[model samples]
Target: MPSTWTTTPVTAGLVHGALELEHTANGILPHRLPARARAQNTDGQLAMAESQPSGVRLVFRTRATAVELDTLPTKRIYVGAPPRPDGLYDLLVDGHPAGQAVATGGNTLTIDMSTGTVEHGTGPVATLRFTGLSGEDKTVEIWLPHNETTELVALRTDAPVEPAPASGRRTWLHHGSSISHGSDAASPTGTWPARAAALGGVDLVNLGFGGSALLDPFVARAIRDTPADLISVKIGINLVNADLMRLRAFAPAVHGFLDTVRDGHPTTPLLVVSPILCPLHEDTPGPTAYDFSHLAEGRLLFTATGDPEERAAGKLTLGVIRDELRRIVTRRAADDPNLHQLDGRDLYGEPDHAELPLPDRLHPDAATHRRIGERFAAHAFTAGGPFGDGTG
Candidate 1:
């Protein structure tokens, strides 16, 4: 029989010292901004709506000599979809499947979901019990549905803990599309943001979302709200690919996004980056392949272009976007001293392209990710650089 653990209530803004993660089949996607949808009507008014929840698993890495669940709620682990008959939350310890928690009674872990109990379902709430684990590093993997979302309310551990000491290192908050999110990178840590953070000896809050990095006011609001010593926003590819707005609207939208972020970080060094070279979208931009053949499966599938057919008729390539971004920043810098711009080609260009071909011709492969990280560290983080003085 498994040991029984106490249950605790989860409150908003509760800082759980535990390192929380959501499970993704490909890898872990960071839970940063809330997901939303955007569409404009004939009247040119934009509409926004809440997006459906996706499945995510929570993985935790720990160095506890011993482990136990001090607080296990009886509430059902709410998955977004209808009750899955065979769905089970599998808990793996140290890479071994330790046990399974079955979904039952409306998938609630506690009795009478109305009361918000922690113990629900057919099994005990505390399904995991560990011993002789002191001083040993262990990985706990929880595989959950990507469509189903869950909030980590709280965590309690029995290990000796010490807070991280305050360091003089600066914080770098970066906002970008999938690339910034570490998409298609070989490993989570290998993502360019992570690599650059390590190389620059700074803390990072990566707000990169795959296919969801369109310039949204809410996202800019989130960036403005986050505390950081340095910041950068990478734009362009998503704009051109989605073709959501024309040149007239694109420039203003970028300016508005920056203005909102600046409301909170007026003096912080801000670097605006353009897109890298993509042959498919360069110059001629109609109907480029969005979804490459999932090599895991042998089939070629394509997704719709975000850019409109008319605008894409004479597609603005990555090169064109780089030049425009440089010009925009240069002109804006005349007034905003702390604002700077970076050409994506500076990180990866035709020469780098000849040597390392991106698997999808969109996102960079692992090798290119490393090269980008190294170059970004050299240019953006070095002493006396644009981002070094915390000034524009």
Candidate 2:
């Protein structure tokens, strides 16, 4: 006997962790930022990063033994660098890792890092199929690639799939830089925030955008509007990465962003996290540049360009940002007891770095991501922690 297949239309209920869905010519495009927030910005990097679907997944319940999905992914290419591997899709059955696959032959975006120019190339859709699932009724989750911009074209399985029921867990909203956006992580669930969410027994809404976690007002508004029991903002890195602002503007910008978030979530458990240890930017200011000197060796690294003496002129550095964040949190916590601060070093400090040094002198590797996620779970979800209720 042959197996029968059923096609399911992708809807909002089936998509988790994305703020909005866009109807495209081929299929649906998931957007991390809502339409209003996306419309208010003109930065191409932000647009690309948000559409990458860092924490987005297609979740449902089914008894299907075989599943197939059609997607058109916009793969990224960097000029004068080694080609990047295809983005990976992680499959989880009944909350455990089951299988993984990658879709090929989609769109392409060729970028020139030095000149800031992007060229687009269109390609054909790719179908990803996964077979050999248990036939018993179980929940299924297809985690989209954390670093690829994918347009879901279709979903087909041997059996019907319906929206999975609520897990009765608290919702956690996290925002951060590329590290939190799953940069260099092996898969979508391998991102620190995703792993931490699982260990903490919470649902996650990740707004981690690569190279775009600056304290932007629109992002604050997006967080203000989203509903979450626990909220955290990982700050400091992108600021130094872009060398976007000075100390005079940085303080006020931080305050304003938090003020906006408080407008809607006054009593939410808010955690402000400083940057993790990045030796190059710990003391030196950035406008971080690629160390193309190793390009011939098929490796790319980052180096700090701004002088350390510029700190005296109020240029921002990781150390300076951490001190300022502590002061701001202490003063604010005096009145708002719900507000808290966590040092990023506690999550990935000097010792951890020494043991598992960053591969590119910037972003942590997959192993380091797991370590950071485990440490974060221990710190934030355990007893006596901000969001914890003094119980495991």
Clash number for candidate 2: 0
Candidate 2 lDDT by residue in tens digits, 258-332: 999999999999999999999999999999999999999999999999999999999999999999999999999
**Per-residue alpha-carbon lDDT of candidate 1 for residues 80-181, written as tens digits (9 for 90 to 100):** 222323334545565455655433222244223234334435322233334454356566544332122233333444553332234466878887866776
Predictions in order: lDDT: 0.56, 0.95
What are the TM-scores, per candidate, against the unseen true structure? 0.64, 0.98
Query: Who wins the lDDT comparison?
Result: 2
Task: State residue 64's C-alpha deviation in candidate 2, in Å.
Answer: 0.8
Instruction: Give the TM-score (vs. native) of candidate 2.
Output: 0.98
Worst 10-residue stretch by lDDT in candidate 2? 383-392
Query: Candidate 1, which segments miss by more than 4 Å at Cα?
Result: 1-30, 34-63, 66-158, 286-315, 389-392
CA displacement after TM-score superposition, residue 269 of candidate 1 (Å): 0.1
In model 1, the worst 10-residue window by lDDT is 44-53
